[model samples]
Target: MPEYDEQDPVDISRPNPARMYDYYLGGAHNFAVDREAADRVLAILPETREFAMRNREFLQRVVRFLAVEAGITQFLDLGSGIPTAGNVHEVVQAVHPDNRVVYVDHEPVAVAQSQRLLADNPYTAVVHADIRDHETVLNHPETRRLLDFSQPLAVLMLQVLPFIPDTDDPAGVVATYRDMCVSGSYLAVAHSLSFDYWPGAVAEAVEMYTKSTHPLNLRTPDQVAAFFDGYDLVDPGVVFTAVWRPDKPVSDEEAISSRAVAGLGVLP
Candidate 1:
C-alpha cells in the first residue's frame, strides 16, 4: 500500500471514480475529492496506479493495432473517461487522419472535458450517455454521424465492466453492442480480476469503489471471458492486460499477477 495522510482535506460532496482515475494518471482534471478518494484507494493497493497506467497502455496498443494492422477506421470507446494524453483519437489519428472516434461516458465532467478537448476535431465526438443504455449510445446522433455501421469498428470497453454488476446483465450489455457491429468488427474488453492474483487487496479496493458513484463489481476471468460470446478471441485469449500482444517483453509474474485482465475478439 502507498503511504498517504488519511485525514487530508477532502470534498466528499462530489467524489467521482472518473476523476479519481484522472488523479491516478497524474492528470490535473481531478478535484480535491477525487484526489482524496484515490489516495485512500492507493493506500490499500499501491499497485493500482500501475494497473491503471498499464490499462491505458493496453488501450493505446489495441487502438493502434486496430488502426494500423486491422485497417479499422471507426472506433467506439464506451465508458471513456476524462481526456488525457494518448487518447483514442490521438493514437488512432496518428495512424490515419481519416480515422473516426466516438467516446461515450456517463460522467458529466468526462463528457465536458472531452467536448473541450475535441471541439477542434471534426472526426471525433463525445456522447453523454450511460454505457448500459446501448440503444441510446448506438442511436445517438453523434454516434451515427461519426461511425458508419457498414464498416468494421473497434469497440473498446477498457476498465469499465467492473462497475457493472451481474444483476444489470453485463453480458447482455455486451451482446447488444456485439450484435450491432458488422462482421470483421472487433470488441476489446478489459476488466479487473476478482480473486486469482490478489484477492484481499482486490476486495478492499472494490470496497473503496462501492463508496463512489460506480461500485466495482469485480468478476473472475471466466465470467469476463463469457462476455465475449459470439465473437472469436484474438491471440492469448482473455489474458492479463500486459500480456495481450504486448509491444515489449512482459514477464510471466508481471503478466499473470496484474489485478486486471483484457482481450480482443473479432466478429465472425
Candidate 2:
C-alpha cells in the first residue's frame, strides 16, 4: 500500500490486477488495498512476483525482436497497465526513435498515467478503452492519430485475454483484432498458466482476484496457443515467459516459478 494524500481517489479501495501488476513491477502507482490484496494472493503463490518480472522481460525482448527483426514501426498495446519502468513505448522507441505506439487500458489510473506521460509526444498516445471493443479500439481518434492501420504494426495482448473468458467469445475478440491487421503484422500474447503446481494456491489466488475490479481467468498452454490460431509463431513458441527470450541465462528456480506463458506471433 502506498501513502496517499486526499487527491487519491477511492478507485484504490477495490483490488485491481493492473495496479497489482504495477506493484509487481516495483512501480509506485498502486494503493494499500491493491498491495494488501496482491500480498494475500502472492502469499498463497509466492512465485507470482517472480512470474510477473519474467513476463515483463518477455515483453521487452519481444518488442525488440518485433521492431528490429520484423521491421515493425507501429505498436498497439492492449490492457497496458500503469506507465512504469521499461514500458512498451520505451523499449520499441529505443530501437526505432520514430516508432508510433498507442497504449490502451480500461483503468482510469492507467489511462491518466499514460495520458500524462505521453501528452507532448505526438508519436505516442494512450486511450481509455476496452480491448474487447475491437471496433472502438481500432477506430479510436487517438488510435487513428498515432497508428496507420494500413501498415504493419505489432499488436500486443500481454496478460489481457484471460480477463475475457471463453464464454464471452475471447477467440472472436482476438480474431477481430487479427482481421484488422495487415499481413505481416505481429501479435504478442502473455497470460497466466493453469497447471498442477499449486492447486490450492491457484484456486485461492483466482478466487481473490476474481473478486477484484478486473477478473482473473487462468488458461492452459493449449488455450494460450489457440490465441495464435491464424498466426505464425516465432521461434521457441509459446513457452513460459522466462524462457521466451531470456536476456541472460535464467536460473532453474527463476524459470520454475515464472508461471506465465508468453510469445510472439506474426500474421501471414
Candidate 3:
C-alpha cells in the first residue's frame, strides 16, 4: 500500500472524489472524511456502491474489448482514480503481455498509489496531471515514451467527465484529444446520466458531490453522445452502462438502475 505523509500533496481534511470512489469500490485507500461523505451519498442513494461496481465492470469490459476485438495494444486512461483491481494495464495486459497503458489523474493520492502499484511494470506508467490539460498529458515524457500516436490506441474517459463543467468546454477538450489520435483509434466514455428515475434522491446525491474536490455534472444521453462527434459509435451506441456489451444477460430494471451510460467510438 502507498503511504502518505504531511509532505505529500494531499488534502485529507476535505472529501475527494477519488478517495470517495475508492470507498465506493470497497478499497482501503480512503480516509475517514472520504468514508463519511460516501456514507452520506449511500444514504441518499442506497445503490451507490452498485453503481460504482457496475462502472468498474464496464471499464474492464470495454478495455478488454478494445484489446481483444479492436486489436488495440495501447491505452490512455484519463482521470483514472486510485488504482484498484482490474486496472487498464491488467485488463489489456491479459490479452497480450506487451500491451502498454498510461494512466492520468490530478489527484495526489491517486497518483501516488498508481506510481507505487505500477513501479514494477515496465509496460505501464502513471502521469500526475489533469485530463483537461491536453498539452501536459499528451506531451508527458512517460506518455510519449509508452504510447506511439502514429499507431491506433484507445482513450478512456470512464466516469470522469462528470467532473468537467461546460465552462471548460469538455466536448472541445475531447475533440482536441480525438484530433491527436490517428485513424482507427478508439475512444471509450462513461458518464453519469441526469435521469428522472429518482429525481429527489439523485438530485441530492449530485448536490453532495459539490462539496467534494470534484463536483458532478450530470449530462443527458444526447449530451454524452456529443463527446464522440468525430468518431463512429460501436454497435448499441450510447446506452446504459450495464447493457453496453454486458457479458451476461441484463434485465430492463438492471439497465435502468445503472444510472449512467457508456459507449465506444472509433475514428473512421
Most accurate candidate by lDDT: 3
For all candidates, the clash counts are 0, 1, 0
Error of 3 at 239 (Å): 0.5
**Candidate 3 backbone clash number:** 0
- Superposed on all Cα atoms, the candidates' RMSDs to the truth, in angstroms, are 5.0, 2.2, 1.2
> Using Cα atoms with residue i matched to residue i, what is each candidate's TM-score against the true structure?
0.93, 0.93, 0.98
| TM-score, ranked from best to worst | 3, 2, 1
Per-residue lDDT of candidate 3, residues 80-157 (tens digit)? 999999999999999999999999999999998898899999999999898988999999999999999999999999
Which sections of candidate 2 miss by over 4 Å? 1-10, 197-200
TM-score of 1: 0.93
Better of 2 and 3 by TM-score: 3
By lDDT: ranked, best first: 3, 1, 2
Highest-scoring model, TM-score: 3
Which run of 10 residues does model 3 get worst, by summed lDDT?
194-203
Q: Per-residue CA lDDT of candidate 2, range 1-268, in tens?
A: 4444456353766888899989877898887889999889878977778778878888889998888888999999999988888998898889978899999998887887788888888789988888888778888998998888788889999988878887889889888989999999999999888756444468878899877997788888888999998999999999878888787987876666678788788888
For model 2, state the Cα shift of residue 46 in Å.
Answer: 1.5
Model 3 Cα displacement at 21 (Å)? 0.9
